[model samples]
Target chain A: MSGQLTLYTYWRSSAAYRVRIGLALKGLEYASEPVHLVQDGGQQHAAAFAALNPQELVPVLRHGDQVLRQSLAILEYIDETWPKPALLPADAGGRARVRALAQAIACDVHPLNNLRVLQYLERELDVAAPAREAWVRHWIGSGLDAVEKLLAGDPGTGAFCHGDAPGLADCVLVPQLYNARRFGLDLAGWPVIARIDAACAALPAFAAAVPEAQPDGPRS
Target chain B: MSGQLTLYTYWRSSAAYRVRIGLALKGLEYASEPVHLVQDGGQQHAAAFAALNPQELVPVLRHGDQVLRQSLAILEYIDETWPKPALLPADAGGRARVRALAQAIACDVHPLNNLRVLQYLERELDVAAPAREAWVRHWIGSGLDAVEKLLAGDPGTGAFCHGDAPGLADCVLVPQLYNARRFGLDLAGWPVIARIDAACAALPAFAAAVPEAQPDGPRS
Candidate 1:
């Protein structure tokens, strides 16, 4: 059941970055095959990738012969297969709480602001640059604000989203906040999110998953 | 923990609809406290609703003091707490696969095509009405097509998304297809999705959760 572990990823893709954090946290290293999201209408849509993932998305994890897609699902698979340093709490309520927080970002925030959606707005809707930026800023600002409230208000928030240790919520949150920061959204309103992001940033798992840390991280 | 299960929901919100289906499937009745998404800039964002959910979106299940947001979280909570008519499988890989199929819709498809995102596209991007619909059709069609392929190609598909029983993935898929049909998106390509939707429709749990079946269901 063991073979070469390969991850199809793009450096700046938040979804890919989330999986990278999970893999690193599990301390399992895999071959990095970066799929450029922006070049050539996204190599993710190429025939080879479609053969791998009909959804034509990055962050497809190849574990031996079983290829998995979707960051949250892949995270669950990793947790199941590895079981160490449990990314989720043992209790059902605790797991529910963690998944809820993760979905607040994954299902609500990041999806609305993804690259393909933005490209659709530009090409199909003819959204001008400024308006597009405004659209990005508006959702990012609101979403981060909501996440901050979720973190600050919920007693579940400890040093991280659940307790003193990093979990699934952090895996999703850190990458999303990084994207928000990339768009230059005013994050001053989000003290709790900033604090949680800082907690995650201190860890090797999260630190290693940053966009700039990837093999094809943007050339500065 | 059982006093007055109030669901903060919208008439047409598929996420909310999923939770409604779960509640029905478990034979648990709840109060439908409508949070209108389009009227008054969304009642979900009101100061009162925000207190319960910082995300301020529909499908907030309030069971006494424990307020749960996110449909999947609520579904899992119900499943784990009640432990009857379980919404997940008995085994781990089966659970993972079911959850993966559910996430394929809840996180990937529904999130990208939700009301707020569509409104943003039109209001911010100046996307003409006709082109906006093309965008919707593109996402819903392709996303459902991917899901259909997953069901058709996998050995997993039986009477539902998992086996002879309806569970998390079916809970998610039914609502998404409801929304897709509401938008008049073409479903000609996804016979698998259509077949599953038909199977779900024959059941009382899903039927009762349809928009028309609710107290706040949109009047035809």
Candidate 2:
């Protein structure tokens, strides 16, 4: 909290949304620098932003001189440095469960349906719009189905993805559910996920972290 | 080290390979259960393996009754449970660096090129062989390019990704390098990655974890 904190983010990026939720959950304040992912061929690709993140991705958290990339890594850094409202569980097994759930979305679900991948489908692979949407829904459905199964069947799942309190897994799941709805995939079948999303949405942390609530969000 | 450790794995799975390296680095012994991903319509789809991992993926670690999925989470679990020869660095920033490097490969690179994704391109999208290879090479190339930049420009990189130790990043990088070679992408362009791979290969932990050395690896 002592250092000057800044977050390079896109309002609609699920990865960035995860970090936003993490920062909010930690009660940490930071300057928001919006990088439009689709404006004029992606502001993320601009020289300055690319220099900040070699991956040219958003949700890069800079604390004074320290710059951190990858949303999950950033979440962990926040948890480790701040050490309040722990994002992960105390026990190793529970920590593994939370991280596994988080990765299920972050690594498996989110990456496949990312802007860059969707753009590649359209531009490079010649995937038509309908087919592209189908592709997005397909991965999101399969991935969410797995997540639903994991959450629904596990006794560890409480008010959130892990236990009573929302944590890292919730940070990842809420944003993914947002993307899932954006792509028109119904969450009726994923009762557990829907319930967790509802629970997380009730919190101010998750509420403020939604893409629509961001500074760069569509002014409706 | 005392309790029975069981790993459900696939020979050529980069994710599974990562777990193997992690176990080897910790000098932990585990019984290997091979889940044939391609043979007999993928044993990973079998009910038993599905029960172990709802995602139906390989490298599920079972210790006693605790079952873990997702290779990265498993790596952290191993690191936390057995702190000897830490997979992550000690400092918070250093740990973030290692995790970011690991996720660059795990989340950004590998997930897009996984078996299910390629299968989707072929079965759902009807993308042909040359185009599929192009897709694979495209992602691997772009992903590794970012990795090369991260490693090459960072002063934190020593003999390995963090310092003079082979940790989580090396576990991820070696497996990814193996996958890149399998897809016929030349590694000559990435001097930093190649150098780190060479440094890691010289160690018994990594040497023993190579895909070709596994019990279920292709013979001859």
* Tens digits of per-residue lDDT for model 2, A119-180: 99999999999999998888889899899889888999998889899899999999898988
Score candidate 1 by TM-score against the native: 0.94
Pairs that clash in candidate 1: none
Per-residue lDDT of B95 in model 2: 93
Q: After superposition, how far is residue B30 of candidate 2 from its true place, in Å?
A: 0.8
* Span of 10 residues, lowest total lDDT, candidate 1 chain A: A185-194
What CAPRI grade goes to candidate 2?
Answer: high
Which sections of candidate 2 miss by over 4 Å?
none
What is the Å distance of residue B118 in model 1 from its true position? 2.7
Q: Which stretches of candidate 1 lie over 4 Å from their true place?
A: A1-4, B1-4
Candidate 1 per-residue lDDT, tens place, B20-61, comes to 899888999788888888788888878998888888788898
Residue-level lDDT for B161 in candidate 1: 85
Residues B38-71 of candidate 2 have per-residue lDDT tens digits of 9989999999888879899888999888999999
- For all predicted structures, in order, the TM-scores are 0.94, 0.99
